[model samples]
Target: MPQVFEFKLPDLGEGLTEAEIVRWLVEVGDVVAIDQPVVEVETAKAMVEVPCPYGGVVTARFGEEGTELPVGAPLLTVAVGSEGALGPVGLVDSGSGSGSGSGAEAGSVVSAVGSGAGSGGAGSGSGSGEAEASGNVLVGYGTGAPVARRRRVRPEAMAVPAAAHVTAAAAVSAAVPDAVQGPVAVVSPLVRKLARQHDLDLRQLAGSGPDGLILRADVESAIRALTEGAAAATPTSASVPESVSAVQPSRPSVAQPAASSAVERIPLRGVRGAVADKLARSRREIPDATCWVDADATELMAARSAMNSAGGPAAGPKVSVLALLARICTAALARFPELNSTVDLEAREIVRLPEVHLGFAAQTERGLVVPVVRDAQARNAESIGAEIARLTEAARTGRLTPAELTGGTFTLNNYGVFGVDGSTPIINHPEAAMLGVGRIVPKPWVHEGELAVRQVVQLSLTFDHRVCDGGTAGGFLRYVADCVEQPAVLLRTL
Candidate 1:
């Protein structure tokens, strides 16, 4: 009998529960050596290629590309020893028929990767466990048994009341059975509650869940009829509209006031998800403030265009306004060390980094991705421009790695891309500040004490007040403006 061993996903890092399988380097019937990179897993942090723990023929693969698999779940079953370590096929659900084995049969004897030698046989139903539901991940090989634990609840509880009406409308349209006994159809939890509280008939309300269904608003409107008479009697003009007092033309009655709720439901995922987490942490952890300034960069623009025209040694990736702005911001960070830091929320402390890796936002079809320019402190204008070009291309091509996305000490968002003047852009969380760049437009400006049309831009600096004050933020922007106004000045500073 061939000795069979199961490989389970290990915790990649900090509280990660699952990872998307990118590719498998090895295939079934292929001989593999120990510690060989057999598979690649893409986590939120980065893409990690995992090494094989044992030398054996690939017996079976249990996951597919882009499928998020829970850590501690078996990845593949490898047979040990000489005579082909093939065991019964381990099935995995990949939706398409392309995935391997039907997984372990219920009551079939199987050992999980982290489970010890003395594990009880696999007891299966619909495979409901922490391995399937949790987002915590396991990344590497370990000999110990899996930790037994219960579900982890969120620190803050989510309230349903605020969205009850919306859900009720969806449910009512879906035709889910409800206890509404009237002409109006029952919709959602909130709608049901509203109707019962106001003594409105639910059967009469139409649903709006999936179809043109009734919702909480339908129920709320029914209750409104009773109270509206009393509200109209009040003397406040805001309470009673002018039309209500005027002689109105009689029109055909509209269909029993179909539910008309105006609210947008956006899924909290991807960029939106990251934005929410960062904003919440920033609010809970950092004190932030803002500073603004107007900069005349005619000389800067002239120099940049001249360099690009000559295609000189300094020439690189069509010198963009954002690239110039990034150079200025990075140069200023050297002058103000405190701005390039993060706060330890637990310890209530600030951390100043030694170098700058400016996070430049690149908007893509998927979402906004920020690929950092590592060691921005050491690079010059040309190098910065080239690196920015490369990183931006990679981001747009969807080829960015997780490492490229992390460790940014400061961030720069160019709203100017969409032709906006200036606005307070949210600080990419944990980073003490984020600089928002506005459009470069021709405006009247004083040059050598004479008024002239010059390329002018607005810079908005939004910083964490907990880590920096208004003065610091203002000084930083002033320094940037100085550098851009006289590009040669950077040579002295560098």
Candidate 2:
């Protein structure tokens, strides 16, 4: 007989609580290998393929695609051991059928069917025992040795009234057909909920997903079709008598509004929602001040071009203007360390971070996300550029992990790509300050006692006034501006 094992949705880590089913990789009666990806799910952070730690024949699956399930909800059940042992008993619910004597009798039949081959197989015990699972933790399954629990069955306990037994058998028989007749081909709970709310029968609709699996869109289409059909069948004002129509106008002309389909309402969830909450909290908690200075970036641009052009085949990644600005920010932070720290309001102390985990804002289709480059103070301009490029690609592809998006000591936001001159960037909450770089364009400027067209850029720094006074903020901004005006000035610290 085969022993059925249930697998629940495991924690995907990074404080994520729930995930929506994106796609299913396996189907009922399919044989799955240990560590095989069973389903792909999308969390608030990223899309991840969850792997099953147990290898067996898939017995059942829960939830449909697009349904959000909380952590620890049963994902699926697998029956392990030989195929012959499964028999008709395997058709029962794997998760709900192991408690009663009759259910256990059916399970015993399944176990007996597999005992022939399982007896000699490695990791298999006596026919009465459960099959062993592979000790692998793909998403927190096999972490420790299984504790044995003995359950004793008494014959007297099974002596219930015949009517009661018949009632119980009828209930089991009724549910068995739904499980064994054929897979429902549905994976999302949301789709089922929507159909229930509209009083639509799911069995009547055709599925659109793989293997005729039902999807949320299918349910929604069904709803729209029913609604439109009903609206078309109903009588309109044309069918009303002229006497009634004329009397209706006199009674305060109450009109039924037509539904508009032009507007789209996107839920503020996931990345966009996280950003909104952080910005709102920052505004609520931090007394921030913004200071701006215009600098001649002609030298900085020239230095970057020269560095990129000088190296040959052995040259590293090209240093970007943002990387150069990041290098300057690190140097400026070193001179004024107060700006590179967060406030611990309860402790009444400013927590100054040692290593600079610099976060740079990148705009993607998902929204604005800050991908942090750890130990930025130790990395040079070329290194910073390479990391920024790597993180930017990840952010665009929505492959950035939670750790990559957090734990920044300071933020560098370059809004120049949008052709903006400057912005008072909100402090990336808890972080003391943010440096904003505007578009570096050719503008007339007085340089070296002469007026000329120089590449000038506006640099804005928004700092938490609670952490540092205006004098400190001004000094930090001045150092950054000096680096922008004269790239050679950075050599003093380099």
Candidate 3:
């Protein structure tokens, strides 16, 4: 007999707690190799393919596609052993051979119990089979060498009475009367949370899953029933006697109800939810302020075009406008380090960071995300441009990892792509400030003591007021604007 190893969902890291199953790569009874991608799941940050460490035949799968499961929930089980050692076992309903039908069916339940007993005896005899531990230290399992299996307790040795099984089955048809009478079989924390929110006793509800495991659907149904019952029990005004009525209008006028058909409700979840939560927290905790300035970008645009035109094959990637702005922001932060730090409110201290981990905002079909470029202060415009391009592509493809989406000391938001002139950007939480760049368009400006058509852009800086005063914020914005007006101003720092 093969030893069955249960593989739970691994931590996708970056403080993510749950993910929605997007697709399954393996099915029940399929052979899988070690470290092979088993399933694709969409977390709050990105879409990730989770790999299984054990190489074996898939014995069971827990959740269906599109189902949201918390981290550490069992993803699947694999039976590992020598080739042809473990024959195909029906896995739809746990060692029970309950057939692919309703668990409430009497014939299926009886067959499942009988088959479980027989399998238990077989499992006991083959307990000496060798089983190796996959050396991968993931969310649940740890690394170790292969070890000989211990004999499993036979089902016959600790079997529940057949009458008890019948009683549990009968409980499925009728509501459980007492909450403390028996154990409630529930697996998902989300299910428990829902039950707790509604003050519904799980013990008083029979589960529809294998071994009477309470599923989310079961709890939802119980809540629905309770709601309908309460609504029905409420007395209506029409039932009151005319004699007991306080006062009645001779002619009652009915007001027309407002139309709700035009309203659309989109669930705030996944990337959108994460963004929403962070923004709300930033607003709640950080004392933020925004300042804007218009600058002549004629020199900056010309410099970029000239550099790209002069570059040969070995000259490397062309610098982007956003990269130039990012580079300038880094220089500005270096001169005014106060704007590059976060406030440790609990400690009642302001942290002035050293290195700049610059994040840039990118909008994807899923939602808006800020992908961080590590050590942006050390990178030149060319290097920063390349990284931004790579992260943007990954964002577009939904292939960015959680680590790539977090830990930014400062953020550069280029909202110009939306054709906006300026925006009061919200500070990316924990970080002190964000620089927003608007579209660079030709405008009539006074240059060199004369009015001329110059490429101009609006720059906005939103900083945590707790960390810096208006003077510091104003100075930082002025330096950035100066760089835009005269690209040569960056030469001194370079």
Candidate 4:
């Protein structure tokens, strides 16, 4: 018996009601296992890859890739055994056992079939079993819908607007697809990413998605051709460093001038849009102040260097400077609980957190993603380092879930990697404070009237002044400096 399961879109946070399918990793007839990523979903903030929850053969994708699907809407259909047939993208109230998108059609409201458990019927529309016919699958199963194949009729290159012309309002007001079988396929995120990478005009590339949707593969194929042509013309003897490779003279400049007429309004709908809102809210709602201090990290550096050099069989993951800092900050927060609190405007009170959930700021292609390292105070330095490594990779690949990105009480942004001396980083919304670590540079310091070169890093602390006073913020910075100055102290704190 061929049993089928339906996978729907999961609730991505921050009041996000829906997401646009960005790409499809699997296709109909493709066999997949539980937790295998099948679709990529582009939320208002980032592109997230959804994994499979139930292992089986793919039957139908309810919503076409590049189509905007409501949260809890069916995205994919999988056949576990020979029990039932999965329906189409758009729903049909028809009882003919053939839902070929010819009934009361709406976007993502596809009719499903199953045994008369009432669990399997036509157009249940509710996001529930047969595996929540139109809701997000578990984290292991990926998010978003399958991208449909589109065929171009004419070169409608000049029909669509430029990237600069698109806005959130425009996106919202854009024509909705009236197809009975899912919304008309639009440009996939993969296509957009590829287009940006190759400097290709998205409007010019005809969509290969269902109902003429443009997919990433389409853009990639075009980019590959363009690159191959360029490579054939150039000689292999000419090489340039990747860091400086972006400085080509022939590249067209996309500089936006400062005049009202000169500036083209780009809509804040996705990652950039979300970032703007969060930053603005943080600035307006939370009163913030920054304090800076320099710490001598010579011993810490020596310890780390020595550990790396004497690498025998280690018990756990290696400790990193970031991990050490996080552990220290978590401990310090225990002393000044005010520093680990968030303002609840709705509740009209300050919520002091009992445990420290550290949000490590990670830079991604889709702006900054802060994945939380929960219960940082309880985790050892080695465990914290491992979590950071895992989350960083997940963020980059758009595999992070809403839970992993939320519920952090504080944040840590690393500027040392960029060789920055110090900076006042914005507070991640709801968090009371953020700690910035500057580059560890050797400089002469006055010790007992004698100048000595020491490895020093500047610690910049930005805090929500509304929650904690300068005295408390200063104390937290001092405590962090002391821990970094004496790396051994962290072990005791942990």
Scored by TM-score, the top model is 3
Whole-model alpha-carbon lDDT for candidate 3: 0.69
Regions more than 4 Å wrong, model 3: 93-263
- Per-prediction backbone clash count: 41, 10, 0, 35
Better of 1 and 2 by lDDT: 2
The global Cα lDDT (0 to 1) of model 4 is 0.63
RMSD of 1: 16.7
What does each candidate score in C-alpha RMSD? 16.7, 11.1, 12.8, 13.0
Candidate 1: Cα lDDT at 466: 76
> Whole-model lDDT, candidate 1?
0.59
| Ranking of all candidate structures by their TM-score, best first | 3, 2, 4, 1
Tell me the deviation in Å of residue 23 in model 2.
2.7
- Runs in model 1 lying further than 4 Å from the true structure: 21-42, 46-56, 63-67, 83-102, 106-272, 311-319
Candidate 2 lDDT by residue in tens digits, 351-456: 9999999999999766789999999999988889899999999888767887888899999999999999989989999899999999999999998899999999
- Residue 385 CA displacement from its true place in model 2, Å: 1.3
Q: Can you write out model 3's per-residue Cα lDDT over 195-261, one digit (the tens) per residue? A: 6546565655667799878788877776655444444553343443332222121123233233333
Question: Candidate 4 deviates by what RMSD?
Answer: 13.0
lDDT, candidate 1, 167-210, per-residue tens: 32342222222332112233233343344444344444444455
